[model samples]
Target: MVIRDTHSLQLVWSSRISEDSTFGLRWTHSIHRSLVEEKYRIHDGQIILTEMSFHDYGIGMENELAPGEKLDIQDGQFHIRNMNRHFPALHLFIGQVRAGHTLLFSGTEIPLGSLHAPGAAITIQVEKRSILNEIGGY
Candidate 1:
């Protein structure tokens, strides 16, 4: 997987992700001041949004459920499950330090703010590379 700044078209971060690789993006909701997390997995060479958990609903929050989607409440947190939304590329707005935008992958916490300035547009997507290119470190 790779993350790039959309405006400048500069590579911000890149990592080798295999099939079934899962990651979560977490940030503080600007209005609610609560932590919100969205989990995704790489399946069939695509990015699928698996789950979303948040403390409270605020602006831009999805209230109505779609087909095959389920909502669960536990410990005062709302979890939306079975989304399985496919995206060619995930775009995110890197919020300020107060938002605490972070990426959780492979047991590592990477702060997106450290990679680019606040309010930067970031695009994350999976890229296919041949075995030869991988071996050559391209």
Candidate 2:
């Protein structure tokens, strides 16, 4: 299948890193994202990538851990080291590796409900929004 007019949207993940353990340690949640470049396709399978910028943001907090200080994250928690097993890996469209054929964005999986079509072309428009405009600044 030939892809036309492909435009890449750079995504920055604001994922939460959690620590869980059988011990009595309180659960802590911190935000961090892998410095990765995310390119989205309009028709990646059953899901269509719309210009839905509102649905594109992940809300989380900033990380405040001292360097070399390890967090006590037990098994089955949302840590950066264990995130790969819990979420889908980043998608690529080159070489032996190809973009995932599922509805996923920024390591999160989206559900596909009866929108699977074959041989369809989809278009997505990206709107530019400055930080000033987002914060009600003129």
Number of the top TM-score candidate: 1
Cα RMSD (Å) per model?
Answer: 2.0, 17.1
lDDT by residue (1-138, candidate 2, tens digit) is 111222333222122222220101111122222121222332212222111111112454214333432333333222222111111122222211122123343354532111222222322232334556445575
Residue-wise lDDT of candidate 1 within 47-79, one digit each (tens)?
A: 999999999986878888878999999899999
Q: What C-alpha root-mean-square deviation, in Å, does candidate 1 show against the real structure?
A: 2.0
Q: What TM-score would you give candidate 2 relative to the actual structure?
A: 0.18
Instruction: Name model 2 segments beyond 4 Å from true.
Output: 1-100, 111-116, 127-138
Q: How high is the lDDT of residue 119 in model 1?
A: 88
Mark the 10 consecutive residues where model 2 has the least summed lDDT.
Answer: 21-30
Least well predicted 10-residue stretch by lDDT in candidate 1: 129-138
Each candidate's lDDT (Cα)? 0.89, 0.25
Candidate 1 pairs with clashing backbones? none
Best by lDDT: 1
